[model samples]
Target: MNLETIQANARSSLGDALKSISVQGVAEHSGKAYGIVALMYHRLALCEMLADVRVDRFQVLLCKSALVRIHLMRLAASGKAAHPLTTCASQNFSFVDAITAGQLDLAVELARLTSDRHEPRSEYEDDFLLHRFMQKRLLHLHAGEDHDFQSLMDRWERIVEGEHAPYFDVCRALLQRDGEGFHDALLAVIEERGRLFRQKDVYPEDARRTDGALFMNGLALLRLAELNGMPTQREYPNIPHFARLPVSKLPLPLDSWMRPEEGLPV
Candidate 1:
């Protein structure tokens, strides 16, 4: 579906979910009632944020993290058992959107898979793979920037040494591949890292910084790719439209009106 359709669907679904949970008498103690409602409200806010197609990957990661927390809160309200509200909220999430736009489903699934079980091995593996992907994308996008290149690679190596080896291996494979367009390669990496963030709450701040760095670096790569005769997707041409000009431009500096200090020649 197009962005508009997706956003509208998300909005309607979120509104309905909020209304359903607004049942009266659900709140007994005044303080507990406020707390429960506040939690639900927080979930609704996350849903709204997720619905906005313009949200960047970093924002999506944050929203999904909040959603997971909200799910846990719902579980608590249900006496530590899975509740229908939780299921409904989860169902509202569009996995396709998560995959294509956010890559958050991976993190969400990982969190769920490990919640009650000991899956440290699998978790570490996923973390390594994510770190590698981020590194590859950074390198490709910032091919000649030695400092950025080394920094990204260093981070990946550290993650590999840490608890995310499998993730590192996966990233290594992708990076080793050739012939992918810079944009395509970068987007793929973004999708994967998005998934990682969704699964593990690994370095929210660092992930955000990395994402921003990649975007700025990608813009530079796109320009360089064009300069190197690489084909790029055609963007719509800007069309000029009639509009009133500003009443006037800002006044030029008074220094321009003043004559220069007396010189030897006129």
Candidate 2:
């Protein structure tokens, strides 16, 4: 089939996956449930990378993701679900994405999670620094906390992860309030990701390996720059103007059946 048909089919599969999960059943606290919910949001967010950015749909999806993550977090806190299978991308679940999508309440709720609620800490230095960077971004955006990120930046500077280092430098410049550094490093990061997308055969097969090649994390960092009162570049390579549209803090109205409190909507 055509690309559109493929995308629609993929989305439909996600819907079917959701249908398989029940809200008030044994699946409510299941790793499967959490993964599905997270994947739903993740896909929607990546879809923003498309040339036709759907700001309205983005709000709805972000709302849905935030609510489900909150529900899952509450369950985890109450010993119902054991933290709901977080990956490096979902360490804090929906907070950074909520910020990128401009969901204030969701960002607040995500911040309240046991200091980001990221489980199974990484032994590698890069992961540790990234986690710290995410925390710094969250705090900087939400509470306007001018945290001292010099230490983290220095540590990231010392690491040698090629192509990914520019991203770290972008974060460093952001936390350090270096607009020129932010601009320069951000361009490198964006182009590097663009290069990888052009040569994705060597890359992992997941969300980043999609059609639009939209850099959601890079977008998030741009949003952080805006939030920090820094002048941001109007555009970047491999990043879309559509994905940069300002989204609403309020998510669209979810169907009653989609409510997490009632369980998986299945």
Candidate 3:
């Protein structure tokens, strides 16, 4: 099958998984319900990531459903006293309805969780850092002045310390002005990213892990660099292992499921 078919199958599998999760007989604000919601959030976020790469709309809906469920979980966990499962009709779960009726803040947080798992936390991290670093592009394209990246960028700079320091530096420089050193800096970070990818031992093993996205992550970075005028012919060494892997086998990063944090949608 082609990329599209593989993606469809993956999305279907995810939908089936979501359907199989029984929220019945579980108490609100209990650890059991929280665990199930967290699992749903984790898998939904993963599907959202996949949808992003393939530009799939149905997968985006799946993500919205996951986000909505997360909002319901949050409400229940906070002692708001609402039936989580009954929030949506049993026969049909409308993702758009959920987003419209749910919390936007929660959706953003979910986006970040999936994004954070893209690669080594230090090197390729961002608030909504996955999918070729599309959050920045999205912010530039769609977000208003109310949306600021300063804090997220600061967090990223803090996390990615040392030899990989140039990662965000290049990002900032490119953000400021594409100067003579822009291409060099971009290539430098990409090279460092490639080096990190070579070290498979650096990744964590978890059910919701996204370590497998390194190949996609690298390709996204390379495309971004080239889009901004980085050299096209430059040798990208030893990274095809990621490209070679089947799209279905990639993993989502995690274990921080229930831990409260931030995110955004693709």
Candidate 4:
């Protein structure tokens, strides 16, 4: 709960994670690294909030974002698809992590890089479609044309229902150019995520450890809105002011994020 405790745990977690990557090797253990790196970011992110009431290592988060991309690409290679477009769900925050932390240019590239590694399929699994839509809508706002975004949303509107529908609504509201609707839908998904976190239903248990107070998902979407010139609330309930603001410029000589090929140093 305390920042001090979270910081200590983060150190322990990072140390343990490095050993795991060193022993298991990055090629075989990327999924594990992805999960662990996610935890590290949350812990560090939480420490920033709890310690100084602001985030400090968001650049590190940007770095972790790249690592997550690498991990997911590797994970996809092992899946049934010929490419790495695996099923993404409420639990999948790597895209959110990437989108929120990096600038639009950098963040969009993360999605592009992941998708490029995979060949196109005649039909994407429903779950794959859902996850891709989540990333695509944001990409559409900045990079794609309005017509393309609408077509994409129309495709998702049919299949997405039940518990996951609200997530789509968040994007839907944005597409409709409804700011209040966007805020309302965004809060809904953020609250739902909080509930899931409280129930310990989140994967990798550590994902929830620090984020119990800070909701990065909400911030990511808000940042997406900001990037697209959409009006955003100055503040949301669970999402703090600092976490929502821009982090820092991408660290150049981008090797800082472990670069996947280089392997984790012990």
Tens-digit lDDT track for model 2 on 46-65? 55335246565655555566
Q: For candidate 3, lDDT tens digit of each residue in 176-212? A: 5555455566567667765665576764332213323
Off by over 4 Å in 4: 1-3, 23-31, 67-92, 115-130, 144-147, 162-164, 200-206, 259-266
Q: How close is candidate 2 to the true structure, as a TM-score?
A: 0.75
For model 1, the stretches where C-alpha displacement exceeds 4 angstroms are 24-61, 64-68, 71-74, 83-266
Superposition TM-score, candidate 1 onto the true structure: 0.27
The whole-model lDDT of each prediction reads 0.34, 0.61, 0.39, 0.59
Choose the strongest candidate by TM-score.
2
Name the candidate, 1 or 2, with the larger TM-score value: 2
Instruction: Give the Cα error of residue 227 in candidate 1, in Å.
Output: 34
TM-score of each: 0.27, 0.75, 0.38, 0.71
RMSD values, in order shown: 18.7, 4.7, 12.1, 5.6
Minimum summed lDDT over a 10-residue window in model 2 is located at: 257-266
Pairs in steric clash, model 2: 23-263, 23-264
The true-structure Cα RMSD of candidate 4 reads 5.6
**lDDT tens string, model 4, 1-266?**
45677677776776676566567755224355555655565466556565566444554554465455545555564572322223233334566766666555655655554442112352344445545655666667767734366666666677664546667788777667678889889888888877887785564454565666667667777876776678987888777666665645554444344432232222
Query: Highest lDDT, which number?
Result: 2
Global local distance difference test of model 2: 0.61
